[model samples]
Every structure is written in structure tokens, then in C-alpha cells.
Target chain A: MGVPFTPRANIIMTICLGTIACVVTSGCLLWFAWPYSDYERHVGWTVEQPVPFSHQHHVAGLGLDCRFCHSSVERSAQASLPPTFTCMTCHSQIWTNAAVLAAVRDSLLRNTPMTWQRVTNVPDYVYFNHSIHVVKGVGCESCHGNIAAMPLTYKAKTLTMQFCVNCHRDPGPNLRPAENIFDTDWHRGPDTPGPAALMALYHLGRRNLTECSICHR
Target chain B: MRCAWPLHVLPGALLLLAAGCDDMSKQHKENPYASPRSAPADVAQGSVEYHDTFHPAPGLTPALLQRGRSEYQAFCAPCHARTGQGDGMVVQRGFPAPLPLATAPTRSATPEQLYAIITSGQGVMYGFAQRIMPDDRWAIVAYLYALRRSQQATLADMTPAQRAIQP
Candidate 1:
């Protein structure tokens, strides 16, 4: 048979193959990196809630403790949101006539809970317990970031497996004194214990924090 | 013909692979506080109903006082200041000032009465029955008494050892 193709066909085929290879390689890289990206992880994203609750006003301005609203953080796996009545504890007296508190009043009157959108969350399979972390001297700001500074709450950290595993592997640097556990603005000071001392103080040295079952189960 | 058959099978294989890509992050299980329904009222421990008669206060110990101090700060410090002065941040922000713990009426009030006040709303103050445990209520009562004593403490009231140690 006579040559069915020109010599230019080889050059065309090489270009076509090179383009396909480049596309496939980039596609694979993007597929793997997509979930790890902050955009996909919802980090720093502000979620809309039924009410525009301001952590800045309540926490920094009014000086309300973290436990005031999230009452079960130290006792339960979940850091429970306050019931409507908890809001009424102050709103009933202070902001009684404000139009902004209409939903809170409605929730109390209707006896239906005002559904709050969770700003930070993990997958259902990951059993993250607030009580253990709080008790172990992990300050609220360590994971939640500067909550007192957030006028409107947003997801402060990417709560990915890598984020969890990084802390699980070495929890010492994150640990704070018991007094500073709830302090959102707490930072290590001159007298603050070092990593090894804190690890020993919290008795975390003996525990296998990175064990799969610790979180997965 | 053989290449055409392979292409047909390839499409089916790709479809099967795509079917497995469904997200497993969220499952059909309930997360804590995920439901919009209001939680059922908390029933008092060792009682059938939410309301219960007087229960004796827990024995006072250093640990109990420590627990009481932390609990008091968390729950009561907003309206009742950390010093029990009834001039807390919330009060400054416009909530009516609660009676200072050292006030005669509050001072003379029985532990059971203080516990009741904490468990059930007394005037504008919301009842913390749903929030604070019964044991914690008693601990707070104990702390309140301690707070009252501290507010009224004089040099004469201090022990000889405490007086000596005072700077």
C-alpha cells in the first residue's frame, strides 16, 4: 500500500497525544486537590442563620462566657446551642422592644426552636467531642478561631482530616491552662507552660490521640 | 467491530464508576441538636416530675467550692457579678440588677430557697433548671454563701493564722 498519510500526520499525532496527556495529568491533580482547597472546605464562609447573632456584641461587649450559650460543651459531646429561654434571660429585659429580636420572641411564643445554622461542622462519621477537648485544656479559640472578634460567625478553620490529625499527633502546643480554656483571646504568655510540660500536665503523653478509633468510632 | 464492543462496555463501566461517587460525608443519622424541634423539658434527677421538694445540699469540700466557683462564673456571673455585687455586665447593659448575695434577704435565705430560686425563675431572672444540674444549683448556693461571707468579712472575722498570713 502507498503511504496513506503525510509526514505532517506524525507531527499532528504527537501534538494531539501531548495535549491529551497534559489534560489528563492536570485533571487528575485537580480532582485530588479539590477537596483540600479552602473553597471546597467552606473555611471562613459565613453561614446565614435565622437571626444575625453577634459573638462580638455578646462575648466581647457584654462579656458573656462561651459556656453561657453553649452550656453543654464541658459535659457532652455536643456544644449545645441555648434554648430560646436562654435568649430571653437578657432580651426579655433589655431588648424587649427591638425589631431585631422579633424572631427570638416568636420562637418563645410559638414554642418552636429557631433553627440556627451551624457555622462549623464535620462529617457524620467523625465523632468530634467538645467535652474532651475543653477538659483537656484546648481553648475554644484553638479551633473556633477569634470568636469574640467575629461580628458574624464564620467557619474559622478547615476541619479536615489533616487538620484533626495534625493536632492529634501533637496536642501539646495547643493546650492552655484551665483558667484560659474559655478565653477566646488567650495566647501563650511568659509564664505559660511549654509543650512537654503541658502534655505531661494534661496526661496526654500516655494516650494514643491519633488512633483511628479515637475519632472514627 | 471488536473496538466498537469495547467502547460500548467502556461507557457502562464509566457509568458504574460514576454511580459510586455519591458523597458519604452526610449520612442518614441524627446529629446532636440537628433537629429543629425543641428539646423535651429536662426532668429532675431522682424525681418523676420536673419539680421536686427540697434536696439536701452536697457536702462542702474544697473541690465542691472550686466546682461551685466555676459553675457560678459560667451561669450567674452575667447578671450577678463575679464578686456577687449584682452589677454584672448584663445588668450594666440594661437587665435589672439582681439582689447582691450579701443582702440581708439573700443572706438569710435557706440553701434550699437559693437552690429553688436557681431551679425556678424568681422574677425576671430565667430559671436555669434546663441548664444547671440540681447538684450544681446546690453548689452555687454554697458558693453564694461563701461569696456573702467574703463580702462581709472583716479582719476580726479572719482566723489568727489567716490574719497573720494577710499582706
Candidate 2:
């Protein structure tokens, strides 16, 4: 009946193994729980639409302004969607016979707003002002990226809180073509005005750009 | 006696691992904002235009106003007050008093102007840009107008057919 180790010793070994397994399980769980963002967190997302809209056709082909749909962006906080009437401003005469114009016509006849799925969405906690950012010289492309070239528009930047903080951390180099601040491809390398020049201009008589309270509460 | 050694060793190892992270606190530390903020004094005496992008929506509907009211209560009533008179308890307790919207000149402002202010906070209030989506802000603007009309409208305004047309 004499064993190498007592039965009490075996119980102790079992308890130790159980504790280690629990610790390992928790460690793995926490590893998965590490705070990575969701698929929508990426700036660019594509969704199925009622109609396949093409920014390339409207903007690049016909040279429509981004403001066409997001009309209130300059005088309002939002760059609101253009109602059916706005589409008809050009479409009613331009493409009245086109089969693709069904959604636009439906909105007008039914008096409903076109349901454009948000391709670019940020988290609720973040605060982004198109007006302030636009006025300050940040180009549409700075965050939105290369819009004229994009056929089907998708978000082009990682709009994470940290992504915002980095740009706000130093907003100097982001501004360009003051008049063409809406252009997506305004900034490029050494020959073009550097961030320091822009930062100096941005901060010329204004306050610091690093104030969290400026962007946050 | 030997069994106790591993237990003590495990905790010691964990403590060492934790100490290693303390060394990387350089980037993790919260730094005070490096630049000065725009002071209240810097704002123009008049309305400062901030709408860099403004697109017209489908306009307002009574249904939109109702939805806006529900959203306003959820997000804003904590501070802006249910009636939007800026009398919320949080504001009275010194949580940055919202501008009294009932008496606010904002009530007389255009829809776009009202939309701008709500989208991008007027003064002490920061923009609801991220908190409330744009459509919701537009809806809230519609509701704000409804609230003003509810206050200013009378039986006379409604019974216009009974009265003579204004000269």
C-alpha cells in the first residue's frame, strides 16, 4: 500500500495542474479580447446599393462637385445627401431614359430621400467636423483620399481615434491649394509645400491644434 | 518544501513581466495638450461661418421631428434640457450651461444655420458631429423648429381661414 508519493501529494499535483490550465485559458481569452476594431472600422467600405453609383462617371466624366450631394457641408455641419430633386436638376433632362436612373426617379415621385449607405463611418465617440477641418485647409483627400480617381467611392483612410490624433497632432503638412482644398490629391512630397509651411500658416494667428478640448469635450 | 518554490517563483516572474511594461510608459503616458486652444475671445462677435461642406437634404417631416425628439432626449436632455430652454439639472449644477435655446437668437436663425450649430457646437458645446449622425442633426433641427413653433404658435395662427388676410 506504500506509494512513491502519498495520495495527498497526488491531490496537490492535480490542483496545481488545474490552476495552470485555468491561467492559460484566461490568457488566451484575453489575447482574443485585445481591442482591435471591427471590419467597419477601416475607412473604406463597400456595400450593395439600390443602384451602382459611380463617382468616376459623375465627377471625373462630368466634373460634378462633391458638394452636389453633400450640399450643407460648407454652410452646415453635415455634408447632407442630395434629394431626388437635386439629381433631377441634371438627371431629369440628361439621363431621363436611362434604366439606371430608376432610384433617382423613384425618390422624386415617392418624395423619399435616397437611401445612400454610409461608406465611411467613424465610431460614435469620435468628433469630426467637416466644416472646421475644411475651413482649416485640410483637403477632402487628406482624409477621404484620391476621390476624383475613385470610380465607386470608398473611404480611403483609417479614421481611428489614433489616426485622427496623429493628423491633429501635426496638421501643418496636410493643407494645400487653399482654393482647391476640396481636391483629393493636393499634397505630394518635397517640392510641394511641406507640413511645416502649412502648419505655420494654419497656426499663424490661431490657437494650438493639439488641444483635445478643441476637438473633444 | 520544494513544492512551494514554484508557486513563489511564478508570482515573482509575473511581477517582473509587469515591471517591463512600466518601462514603455513613454508613449502610453497622457500628455497635456501641447498647444493653446482657441479662446472665447478669439471667436468673432458675429456668427462665424464653419460649414465647409453643406448639402441640402430632403427637408423635414413631422415624423422626422418625432424621431429627433426621441434622439434629443437620449443624447442631449442631460445637458441641453428637454424643452431646450437650457435648464437641465446638469447645466444648473455647473456642467457648462447650454445657451438658453428658448430665448436664443438661434431660434430665429435659418435652417442651415441651425443645422450648422447643432452639427458643430455653437460655443461651450462641441459639435455633435460624431455623437449624433448628420441625418439625426437635421432631424433635431426640424424638431427645434417644431419646439419654437409650439411655443410661439397660437390658436390665431391656426384659425387663419376665420380671420381677414393681413394687409
Model 2 Cα shift for residue A165 (angstroms): 0.2
Best by TM-score: 1
Q: DockQ values for all predictions?
A: 0.47, 0.01
Q: Where is model 1 more than 4 Å wrong at Cα? A: A1-18, B1-19, B38-55, B157-167
Q: Could you give the DockQ of candidate 2?
A: 0.01
Predicted candidate 1 versus true structure: per-residue lDDT over A26-140, tens digit per residue: 9999999999888998998888888899999999998888988888898889888887878888898998999888999998887787788888989888989999999988999
Candidate 2 per-residue lDDT, tens place, B1-167, comes to 26767897999999998888742313432222211221111222244347735557546787788767755764566566788887654455445566666675876688788877766666655455544567777888788877777788776677757555564
Candidate 2 per-residue C-alpha lDDT over A36-59 given as tens digits, one digit per residue, 9 for 90 to 100: 344435445655566788877656
Model 2 error, position A15 (Å):
16
User: Chain A only: TM-score of every candidate?
Assistant: 0.94, 0.76
Cα distance off (Å), candidate 1, residue A182: 0.7
